[model samples]
Target chain A: MSANEEAARHREVRNAWALSAPALILLLVAAIGPLFIMLVYSFLTPGQYGNVEWKFSWDAWIGTLYSRDIFDGTLKLADAHLTIFWRSVKLSLLTTIITFIVGFPTAWFIATRSPRSRALWLFLITIPFWTNLLIRTFAINEIIRNEGLINSVLMWMGVIDQPINMIYTDTAVFVGMTYVYLPLMVLPLFASIDRFDMRLLEAGYDLYASRWQVLRRVIVPIVRPGIVAGSILVFIPALGAYVTPRILGGGKNMMIGNFIELQFGQGRNWPLGAALSVLLLIVVTIALMFYVRASTKGTNNG
Target chain B: MTTDVAVEARNAVKAFGQGETAVRALDDVSIQIRKAEFFTLLGPSGCGKTTLLRLIAGFETPTSGQILLDGKDITNDPPNKRPVNTVFQSYALFPHLSVAQNIAFGLEMLGRPRAEITKTVERMLALVKLEAMAGRKTSQLSGGQQQRVALARALAPQPKVLLLDEPLSALDYKLRKEMQLELKRLQTETGITFIFVTHDQEEALTMSDRIAVMSAGHIQQIGGPREIYTRPVNRFVADFIGETNFLSGEAGEGRVTLASGDVVQVEGAEGRKGKVTVVIRPEQVRLAEAGAAETIPATVESLVYFGTDTHCHLRLKDGTEMVARLQSPASGEAGLQQGQSVGLRFAPGAARVLED
Candidate 1:
């Protein structure tokens, strides 16, 4: 702590802040600004023609899980919206679990390859994203449709009498979502597993542990941070996913994002849509907080 | 001829890659590890000693030849199927498991009863003197503590053979010295065949029952510490194990002739009549005052002082360079200054004349 060194450290801190201030200001304007506007709009009333009336009201908050019954001047729980929300939550959880089950080994394969082949495997994992995700979602049709590649091949081989109805089903939606978001799960897992010290696995083997025990007791526990990170990456995006469900789900099994879109589009209720958006954000934030707490607890115990 | 050999490698060969880029990591190596012996494979880096150790541990299969454990062929056995364990150089304890859990891992893998596992883990914790730290995370341990954990975890399973890969190399000098004795004590008590690998000559000398000296993926010699140091079969083993002064000369029956036409009498010349190199350790070349009988004439160059001794560097009449360690400052000719004439004496059978 010489005086000159202290002055230099202060200068470094000042320079760092100076370099970072522009990005901070940009985030405040672009990201936080919209959220603030949305929050205020959720408290405002909607005018006759889908415009914000700019007056304060709690009616929009009340309308999030309720719809007005014009005959009785009373509120009733919006069963359709609740069902959509619940379905979105369930599908998101399922997607996270499936992605993890598949991603863990995929990440391990990438992480354990020779340095020359590791880059190639990672590149192959991300190849699905070469085309736009929307196009890839549509490509599923060529495989799952009645006259698509799968049905044609199956009938030509005489394995099936008719094409199975896969489109607009929950299975199709899950398949589409899993394929689209798999890289999201794998990248974080790879980052963590790659940094793991492989000697621990060797030690496990030397101690007479089977390959399964090594993975269960050694590899999985060490890479838990990656699992948590990958789960978060898949779960949050899958919860708000509207594109895959709209196209693959045939608008039949609507996610929360589709519900929100309906509120702003055909439903023409701007205030209710804003309020629903706020509710989704609140739910995601609470879930994230719970995850963060649990992960911290895990680290503390470890 | 009939000692109970625990581990044996017969003409093992290991090669990596193919075509023009191929490399032989182990070249036609064979060894016998006796039961309950502290055997060390000593060599410099890239000398294939560690590879040989891994082969015995069942981590690597030989490209050719057979490995036997207690007279049973185990070359085809996977690592987990073999009754051998290793204390890795990195001491790869699971970062998530506590010290006791790490020691208990092998027993659990064997499907041992719960009471037996607990008792064995408690004994291991006591053996490593880590009982007070049983619940502590391995990540929280010091290097020495973690090393003990690795040793305890490997030894807990009571394997027939234990492999240690440069286990003490990562510790500080004081800790290494202490653990060397500790390891030897543990081996004596357990009566397990210990195969230790290291490049340090002193470590091999201090700890091993016998040392296998290797260089460039080839074994040069295998013998007890005294035998290996006193009678190295080749130049590589002589140069690697300790400091030596080489004299180029021609060997006759009990005599040798220097390049400068000076004749020196020596025993064990192998009765040959070609060029040879006589290797002598520094301490074995005794330095005395000039005009001593049966001593070679030499001029003192410098007396380099070590704490307990002085190395008297000198040149003989035939211009052969030599160094002799004097154990006492008051020893003969030790007080001689630079350029003083002194007579150098070789102890009986101290100098070994090797065929070049």
Candidate 2:
């Protein structure tokens, strides 16, 4: 090629590299690099100066495999961790199921409305998202506290002789997590249900299917992918929730998140905390992968 | 007294909106569809043909009317309760179901015995020539296959009346023509009343035993395709059903005088003593050699040739443009060229007086 053509090719290559470098760097720093560090920490042992010791050993894995901490009262065993993990899973699952029950109908209702009404409903649902997460959590905490509005109302109505302790429980964690993640669940559900072809429902009606039969056979299958996506959005974050559980749950109903934070902060065991974080990551990844694969199969079958 | 009367709508009226803002979609319209015949509702868009079909299918309630199927009023029934099924314009096949499942859907809805449903579904698949594709998914099927699946699914239950709303409009020209023949055969074989809605006049003309031509929420004419086409009652039906050349004229007594001073006897227009339109088809205009006797003097304005025939556009001395289709080399070479002076004539009964 001529000199100018060669020069143009070089410029094109350089410009392409320049445009893609930032995103590549971001992926490496935010995802690949942290994962690599976590893998190394999973193998390392903690040193005296609150740092990881440079060594290659199966000590942390073995420590995780066996029940040393629970025996010595320094840390908890598999049962404690497993119990916490199961509780987290159950809470997150409940949140997802409840969110779908509340959100699907709301999304379908909004989607079926006129465009003006749809916009107003979407705006109302999104308004809570504009507030800071901390403020929203604190607001819920105040509303459901022992001396808060709910207890006060019950006292005035003579429904209770004493104020009910509503906050600082697993129920409080669920309420707070659901409130925080309700919008995240709703938007995707709305999008998927909006894309549903309304004519298919009419076809179902013409075929002699009752109203509920149409819902089961037509509407639900068509919106299954959205349900899966929305559940993942709600469940994954609810599993690893720290602030909501910490504030609304206080210290009584400490979830796996609080346990991990305790290992890293008060326990001063870097490797153990990293190990717990890694375990949480694996559980979430597996659940999400299974959900995605199943929902994809559902979409294809449809 | 009339066991053959399959569907009857009495003074059906459907209005949109409410009160003063309302627009009448079906204005006191009534139609009777007999059993074992192909009836077509032909009209332009916004003419309420599809609305009328939906009313029969029980998808929409008439503002004020009675819809009877087999001597029982079904106007208050929901779609699922009615004895009718519709093949939608978009097909509306269950996207999640296979071809067999889609066809078997209606049978399943009827709470039929499983073995009987299977037999009927298989029979329908064979009827639509889609037996081989029954195992395939609906989304994987081609448009023609989907069309056949929709047809089979609607027919499987053997509804009292089958309503098709522009079912063949989505297919290509060749497939549409093929489906038209297949549908006629299917109707005859099954002996079911078919009420089909279409805006294409050729489709109505080719497939229907009778046609109801509608315009502006009213039935302008209803008869056999030939009767509706050849004996249209108004200018809209004349222009809508086929191409027509309109000549403005003044009518008094039994004769109408064209602007060119040619007077023709138009029966049934005796009392119309004001401005009127005389409608004539282009093919009805006969071309003659220059200076031919009893022919109006005209000049060819344009010539368009097809493989089978040639169309000659002419302007009379009074500047009224007309077109004539000439077939064969002898007829085409009757000395006609652009801007060439010629003569034009029509038989006495060819043109009809019309009101808009």
Candidate 3:
């Protein structure tokens, strides 16, 4: 390489690092800093009145997996923690599936719109992101409650004798999550599907493929990276969800988010909360790994 | 309505948008393609050739027309139900599927048995000479390889007719030439009607059994390649296909009086008088001694040697320009030089008379 070209390349590398330094420093302070603290404190004993003690402790990790008969050293399943984890997983999985079912068609409609109107449709998709999540969940609360718009209309139409108990149920939680996270799914789905060549659809039809076969065999496989990316985006947040389940699932329903909050607030077990937070972070990391693998697999195949 | 008429369009009209924004893409166009023949729609870009092909493929519905396949009205039928397939210009092979799987897709769409699909896919792979790359993804193949895979995939179902929409326009010149001959061979071997669309006049002339030359959403002429080249019906056909020297004059009794008041005899001008455009092929105009029977007086303007032949640019006494393509040996022996006056002779019927 020439000296001039080498010097110019070094300048580019320096420029990249200079641009990245601010974000790197902010992440170290805001995210990794707290995470390191949590990891360290998970191994320390809980002091009285919600503080960490310097003394060593194994009880927090032990409490995550099992309950103890200290005398016999025999282990039993800790259904208390396990139930919340399983509930979180189920809720997130259901939310991801339902969001995809609704988001795919909406994304397709937006992607196929005329270029002039595409911006308007995409703007509508992002309107929800402009509002506060807490407000959106509570706004949904009014509609699903007794004497709300749906039940009032249904009863007025003679479909029901009285207002149904739609609030304070798992159905409300499912609905809330799907509503809030739909835009997340739609954005990525739009990016992938929008870049797709519409001529391929015509080619599929010309080659005698049925509509369903085209969607299944051609469209879905091509947009799969977007689906996986959106799954991680929606599922991870919904798994650790706290506000919607509390507001719409109505406090009677508890998720992993509420459990971790209770450990630090009412239960006052700092070490256990830190350990549970670490575990949740681990689950999220695995989800991120899956996203990386899926994206890289796309490039390797190309 | 005959059985030999593979595909026919009657007065097809396609208009996009409405009111002020409306553009008529195909204006009352009609043509018939014969069965088992290599037919081509030849035109420049935006001449509505692709739109016509799309109408036949069921991608677009004509505003007013009847499209028939083997005497069956299929204007409203969906593409999936039609007895036709296409090799797309982009070669839209499924990126996620292997080349073999791409070839098998149409067969599977037809609900063919798995064993039959496998056998047909194998045969098609070998036919396109992509057998060694059968298991590779479509994206892994080169542009030429992918084009062949697309051809194999579209041809696997053995449709009654195949629509190729400029399928060779994307490749480099070398690959395009190779694929052009390859596609011709494929069409001949399969004995299926192939309607190819292209903007290339050379490709159309080289590969088509019959060429439909379109312009401004209307078909200007349709005939065998040789006939279209040799005997164009209008000035547009003459100017578009190849080089021609247009001589405008007053015609009468198989002759024209040049503007310089020199009487010249020409073919295809019988019983016609008044102003007309006479298109003469460069190769047909012969040069001899300064004065000869059935010849006109002209001066050599310039000479451009292209190895095997030399194009002698000439100007007649009336200030009309013409070009004559002369072979190297004969033109050299004639001792023709720039600024030299000579007699230009043409055989009977070598010139065509057309309305300006």
RMSD of each: 3.4, 3.9, 3.6
Candidate 3 chain A: minimum summed lDDT over ten consecutive residues — where? A293-302
- The TM-score between candidate 2 and the true structure equals 0.89
Across A1-302, the per-residue lDDT of candidate 2 in tens digits comes to 99999999999999999999999999999998988898788788877656688887666665553456546556445676666777788888999988888899889988999999999999999999789999999999999999998999999999998988879988999999888999878899999999999999889989998998788878888888788889989998899988999999897687888877886677666687778778889878997888888777764334
Which clashing pairs does model 3 show?
A: none
Residue-level lDDT of model 1, residues A1-302, one tens digit each, is 99999999999999999999999999999999988888998999987778589889999999988888999889999898788888889889999999998998899899999999999999999899789878888899668867888888888999998887888888888888888889999999999999899988888888888999888878878888898899999999999998998888887788889988887888777888899999999999999999978875674233
Candidate 1: residue pairs that collide: none
The 0-to-1 C-alpha lDDT of every candidate, in the order given, reads 0.88, 0.86, 0.89
**Chain A fold similarity by TM-score, each prediction:** 0.92, 0.88, 0.90
As for DockQ, the candidate ahead, 1 or 2, is 1
Q: How far is A135's C-alpha from truth in model 2 (Å)?
A: 1.8
Q: What is the lDDT of residue A1 in candidate 2?
A: 100
Docking class of 2: medium
Better of 2 and 3 by lDDT: 3
lDDT of 3: 0.89
lDDT of 1 by residue, B30-125 (tens): 999898999999999999999998898888999898899999999989888888999999999888888999999899888899999999999998
Query: Candidate 3 on A73-133: residue-level lDDT in tens?
Result: 8889888778778878898999999999999999999999999999999999999989999
> How far off is residue B287 in model 2, in Å?
3.0
Off by over 4 Å in 1: A1-20, A40-46, A52-79, A124-131, A139-164, A295-302, B1-3, B19-22, B270-273, B328-333
